[model samples]
Target: MTHYDGWFMLAAILAAFAANEVWRVVGVALSARLHEDSAVFSWVKMVATALVAGLVAKLVLNPTGGLALAPLWLRLGSVAFGVAAYALGRRSLALGVAAAAATLMVGTAVIAPGAPP
Candidate 1:
C-alpha cells in the first residue's frame, strides 16, 4: 500500500468521529431539557419508529447478500412468525427477534438443503 493510504484512512476515521461526535454532543445537550412525555419527544420517537419500520420492510422485501438467497415466502413468513411471537410473548422484543431468527434458519435449511450453513 502507498504511504498516503494510511494518512487518508486516518483522515476518514477522524472525519467520521467528528461527524458522529457532534451529533452525540448535541443530543446530550438537548436531552437534558427534553421530557419523555413532551410532544417534541413523542414526535421524535414516532419518527424514529417509522424510519425503523420502513427499513425493516425494505430489508424484508428487497434483501441483500445471504438473506437475498432465501425465498420471499420464507422472509415474509419469518416476519409474521416474529410478530405473532412478539404479541403472544407479552410483547417481548427479545423473544420475537429470536423466534424470527430461528424460523429463518430452520426454514432455509429445510427448503434449501444446499445453502451454506
Candidate 2:
C-alpha cells in the first residue's frame, strides 16, 4: 500500500475505535444513576459473561488459522485445566493465563506431536 493509503487506513481505525469508546463513555456516565443490583444490570452482566464464555469456547474447540492445526482434544483439555486452575486460584488472571499456557503446551506435546501447517 502507498503511504497515503496507510495513513487513511490508520485514521479509519482510529475513528472506529473512538466511535466505539463514545458509547462506553456514555455508559460510564450513566452508571452513577443505575442501581448496581438492579435486574436490568444483572441481566446485562450475565449476557456479557455468557458472550465471553461462548467466544472462549469457540476458540478452544475450533481455533482459527495457526491454532486450527492443533489437536481438538488438546485445546479442549487446556481450557478445562485452565478453568480448574482459575477456580482453584480464586479467579486470578495471572494464574489462569499461566495455567492455560502450561496446559496447552503439555497437551499438544502429548496428543499432537506431528500436527500440520
Candidate 3:
C-alpha cells in the first residue's frame, strides 16, 4: 500500500511552493521600508556573510563526490590558493571560483586516491 500518488505529489509541490513564496513575498514588502544603512540592514548583511562563510567551511571540511576523493589539507590549501588568485587578480569572482575548481581537479589527479600525496 503506497501512501503517495499523483494527487499527493501535486499537493506536496503546491505546498512547497506556497511555503517558499510566503517568505519571499514578506521580504519584498519589508524591503521597501528598510534603509540601506540602517541597523537592521547591517544585521542582515552580517547574517548573510556568516551564512556564506559557514557554507564554504562546510564544503572544504566535508566535501562530496569528486571533492571527497581529495585529502582535507589539499582541499583547504586549494581554497587558499584560489583566494590568493582572486585577490591578486583584482578580486574577480570568476577568477576565484575557476581557480578553486581547477586546483581541485588538478590536485586530485596528481594525488589521487590509493596513491601517495
- Report the Cα RMSD per candidate: 1.7, 3.1, 3.5
lDDT comparison, 1 vs 2, better candidate: 1
* CA-lDDT, candidates in order: 0.95, 0.85, 0.88
lDDT of 2 at 85: 89
Write the residue-wise lDDT of candidate 1 on 1-117 in tens digits.
Answer: 788999999999999999999999999998999998999999999999999899989999999999998999999999999999999999999999999999999999999898678
> RMSD, model 2, all Cα superposed?
3.1
Decoy 2 TM-score against native: 0.72
Against the correct fold, how does model 1 do in TM-score? 0.86
The number of the candidate with the highest TM-score is 1
Residues 1-117 of candidate 3 have per-residue lDDT tens digits of 256687798899999999999999999999999999999999999999899889999999998866677899889988998899899999997999899889887888778556544
**Candidate 3, backbone clash total:** 0
Instruction: Give candidate 3's whole-model lDDT.
Output: 0.88
Segments in model 3 whose C-alpha atoms lie over 4 Å from true places: 1-4, 113-117
| Positional deviation of residue 111's Cα in model 1 after best superposition, in angstroms | 0.7
